[model samples]
Target: MAKLKDKRREKISVATEIDRLEERRSRCQDNLERAEFRSRKEKLTEKERQELEDEMAIMNERVQKLNKELDTLRGENRKNMLLSIALLAISAFFYYIFFYNEEDP
Candidate 1:
């Protein structure tokens, strides 16, 4: 089995991936913006329609990828939060059992 990554490293890895995804999304958005008020196809013929379809397809693919990346980021964040909570609880329990002695004893 692979060793589990520490929470900090996991967070950093997720953050890097998130940044890359956002960059790709921004590029896709830029492509669309650059194509605005202009024909995506070469001429006013079948080729032009095909070009438009291709652009649309690319845009849709990028959108889907971005959504997946966002979902992963959310999941990592949730895992980190839950892990922190669990650790805190475990630490408190240990303290109560050992270090937190009652003076009256």
Candidate 2:
């Protein structure tokens, strides 16, 4: 029971973290898009343009990192599911061997 609760809590926490990361990534993407539009539509000093480019680069990196983290979390969830299935199969096998018996008439 405790283990189950722990797993549930951990799953919830991981899901929450993923949600937060996704939100952050979305915001960064929006910012990047706005910056791109601004760069295309307006004239700027060379220094300002360079700064905007740097900011866009940082945003891109952040988006990539978030995507990688999300993928890793998804993979971990898959691994956990597989492990749970394996455990259930093992438990069922043991139960069948130990508890399921036929009586002779």
Q: What is residue 31's positional error in candidate 1, in angstroms?
A: 1.5
In candidate 2, what are the lDDT values of residues 33-56, reduced to their tens digit? Answer: 999999999999999999999999
TM-score against native, each model: 0.62, 0.70
* RMSD of candidates 1 onward, in order: 5.9, 6.3
Among the numbered candidates, top TM-score falls to 2
- Steric clash pairs (candidate 2): none
- lDDT tens digits by residue: candidate 1, 1-105: 234555554556666767767888888877766654356433557787678768867887887879787888879868988998999999999999887675764
Q: Which candidate is the best by lDDT?
A: 2
What candidate 1 gets wrong by more than 4 Å, as runs, is 1-12, 40-46
Q: What's the residue-level lDDT of 22 in candidate 1? A: 84
Residue clash pairs of candidate 1: none
TM-score of candidate 2 relative to the true fold: 0.70
C-alpha lDDT values of all predictions:
0.75, 0.87
Stretches of candidate 2 exceeding 4 Å from the true structure? 1-12, 94-101
